[model samples]
Target: MTISIAHLGPPGTYAEQAAVFYANWLVKKTGIEGILCPYPSIAQSLQAVASGQTQLAVVPVENSIEGSVTMTMDTLWQLDSLRIQLALVMPIAHTLISCATSLDKIKTVYSHPQALAQCQQWLEMFLPTVQLIPTNSTTEPLQHLENDITVGAIASSRAAQLYNLPILANGINDYPENCTRFWVVSEGEVEANYRMSSISPSHTSLAFSTPANVPGALLKPLQVFAQLGINLSRIESRPTKRSLGEYLFFVDLETDRSSVQMKSALADLSIHTEILKIFGAYNVLPISKDLI
Candidate 1:
C-alpha cells in the first residue's frame, strides 16, 4: 500500500521540501513509493492524520534558530492520541534572490512571513529597515513582487533557481545554526530506519503535566534525567485545557527506557504527573548540510 503523507504548500514550501526529502530517502531505502499530499496549513496536515486519510505527515516542530513553532505545539495539545513516531532535521539555507539588475537598487524584501521574522536581525543589519513584505510561503516571494530590479526576495536557493530568479547572495539567514526539526506522525511501524533498529529504539518522547500544577512540579522529572545522565533533546511547554495557568510539558529523553534507570524514572514521574504518554522511540538519522 502506498503511504499517504501530508506537508505544507503546493510545492517548494519548506515543509513540502522536508516531506519530499524523507520520502525520497524512503524510496532509496525500501523501494516503497509514497503519495505526497500538500496541505495549506499544519492544522490541516494534522487533521489528515487524525481522520486516518493519510499514513503519515511531516510537521515542523522546531527550528534550531527560531525555537519551537507555537502553532504546532497548540495542535499537539489538541491531538490526544496522536504520536510522533520519528523525527529528522533539515538544514535551512536562505538566499537573497532577484530577477533584476543589482542588489544596490533593490527597495523591498519579500519572503514567507516566518522566514522574514527569522531573518529580522540580518535584515536590520544589512537592509537598513527596508520595506519587508511577507508572502504565503518562501517559494513564491518572487511571484508576489512586481517583477522589477528594485525589489528582491529572500528564499531558498532551490526556490530562486527553480523560478529563474538570480541569487544575489547565499547563506543569508541570521543564524548559521539553522535547522528545522520535523516529526513524522504515524500508527504503523517505520520501515525507514531498519538498518539502525537496535540503536533507534532507545530514544523516546513523552508529554505530561503535573497534578498539582504547582511550581517545580515540571522541573522535577528533568532532575531525574540529569541524575541518571539521560539526555533531553528538546522540551516545550503547551497550554493545558485544565485551567488558565495550567500547562503541559513535552520532553524528549535521549535514552529509550528499556534500561533500569529509564524505567525507574518513568515509574516515579508517572506517580507525580497527571498525564504521561510516550510518543515513540525511533532512530533519528543525521541530517546533511544544505546543498545550496
Candidate 2:
C-alpha cells in the first residue's frame, strides 16, 4: 500500500521538503511507497491524519533560530490519537525571489511569519523600507512575484526554481546555521513497516497537566526524571486554554519510551500530573547539506 503523507503546501515549502525526504527515506529503508498530500496549514495537515484523510503528516515542531512551533505543539496536544514516528532536521536557506532589477525596487516582502522572523536582521539591513507581510506558507507569495516588481517573497531556493522566479538574494536568514526540526506524525500505534535501523540516543516526547497552579506542582513531576537520572532535552509550557493559569507541559526525554528507566520514570511521573500523554519515541535524521 502506498502511504499518504500530508504537509503545509502549495508545494516548495520547508515542511514539504522534510516530508519528501522522509518519503524517500521510507522507500529506501522499508520499500514502502508514499505519496505527498499538501494542506494549506500545519494544523490542517495534522488534522488530516487525525481524521484518517492521510496516513502520516510531517509538521514543523521547532526551529533552531525561532524556537518551538506553537501550532504543532498545541495541535499535537489536542489530538490524542497522533504519535510522532520520526524526526527530521533540515537546514533552512531563505531566498528573496522577485522580478525586480535591484533591491531598491522592491517595496513589499511576503513569507510565513517564521521565515520572515528568521530573516529579520538581513531584511532590516538591506530591504528596510519594504512592507513585510506574513502568509500561510513560504511558497504562498511566490505566484505574485511575476506580477509586481516591487513584491518579493522569502522562501527556499528550491521554491524559487520550482516557481521559475528570479532570486534577488540568497542566504538571507539572520543566522547561517538556521534549521527546523519536523515530526512525521501518524494516528494510532506505530506500524512495523515504518521502523528503521536503530539510531542511537533516541528521544521521547510527552505532555502533562498539573492539577493546579500551586507551587511545587510542576517541580514534583520534574524531580521524578532527575531522581531517575533521565535527562530531559526540552521542556515547554502551553496554556491548557480552559483557564488563564492552567497549563500543559511538554517535554522531550533523551531515552526511548520502552526503556526500563523511562517506564519507571513515567510510572512515577503520573502520580504528580493530572493528565499525561506519551507522544512517542523516535530517531532523528539530519538532512545533509548536499541534499538540501
Candidate 3:
C-alpha cells in the first residue's frame, strides 16, 4: 500500500521538496512507497492528516531567518490528535527569477511575505524602487508571470527551473545560513519506531494552560521540569481565544517524552495546569551541506 503524504504545494514549493525528501527517506528506511498530496495552505495540509485524508503531512514550523511559523504552531495546537513523527531542516536559497535576463529590466518583485522579509536587505540594495507584492507561497509567483520583462519573482532554483524562468540573481537572501525546520505530522500519538535517525538531540513538544490567574499557577509546572533537571528548549504563549488574559503555553523539552523523569514531571505538572497536551517526541535533523 502507498502512504499518502500532504504538504503545501503547487509543484515547486519548499514544502513540496521537503515532503519528497521525507517520502524518499521513508522508502529507504522501511521499503514503503509514499505519495504526495498538495494542499493550498499549511493548516489544510495538517488537517488532511487529522481528517484521515492522508497518512501523514509535512509542514514548516520555523525558519532560521524568519523565526516560527505562527500558523503552523497554532494549527498543531488546535489539532490535538496529530503528533510530530519526524523533523527535517532544509537549507533555503532564494533566487531572483523572471523572464528578464537583466536585473535592470525588472520593475516589480513578487514573492511570499516571509521570502520578501528574508531578502529585504538584498532587494533594497539592488531593486530599491521596484514594487514588492506578496503571494501565498514562493511558487505562487511563477503562475502570475507574463511576457513582460518588468515582473520578477523571489523563489527557489527548482521553481525557476520548473517554470522555465531565467534566474537573474542567485542566492539573494540576506543570510547564507538561512534554513527552515519542517515537521512530519501524522494521525494518533507518536510512535517510537517512527522517530528520525539523527545525531542531534531529541525534543518533546507539549501545550498547557492554567486553571485560573492564581499566584504561581504557571510557575508550578515549570518548576516541576526545572527541579527534575529537564531543560526546556522553547516556551511561548499564545492566546487561548476563549477569553481575555487566558493563554496557552507551548513548551519544548530537550528530552524524550517516554523518559521516567518526564512521566513523573508530567504527573506532577497535571496538578497545577488545567490542560496538558503532549504533541510528540522526535529528533531534529541538523542542516548538512549535502541536505541543500
What TM-score do all the candidates reach, one by one? 0.87, 0.97, 0.93
Candidate 2: stretches off by over 4 Å? 197-201
Root mean square deviation (Cα) for candidate 1:
2.6
**Which of the predicted structures, 2 or 3, would earn the higher TM-score when compared with the native?**
2
**Which one wins on TM-score?**
2
Q: Relative to the unseen true structure, what is the C-alpha lDDT of residue 253 in candidate 1, on a scale of 0 to 100?
A: 81
- Tens-place lDDT per residue, model 1, 129-195, is 5799887667655675545877888877777666766888788888887888888886444554422
What range of 10 consecutive residues in model 3 has the weakest lDDT sum? Answer: 192-201
Worst ten-residue run, lDDT, model 1? 191-200
Which sections of candidate 3 miss by over 4 Å?
Answer: 190-193, 197-201
Sum up the clashes in candidate 1: 1
lDDT of 2 by residue, 5-111 (tens): 99999999999998888888899888888899999999999999999999999999999999999999999988988988888999999999999999999889999
Error of 2 at 175 (Å): 0.7
Residues 1-292, candidate 3, lDDT per residue (tens digit)?
5789999988799999888888877787777788999999999999999999998999998889998888888998889998988889899999999888788888899989999999999999999999999988999879778577899999999888888888889999999999998998899964344456453337888999998888888899899999999999888888899988998999989988888889899899889899889988888765464654
In model 3, residue pairs whose N, Cα or C atoms come closer than 3 Å (at least 3 residues apart or on different chains), thus clashing, are none
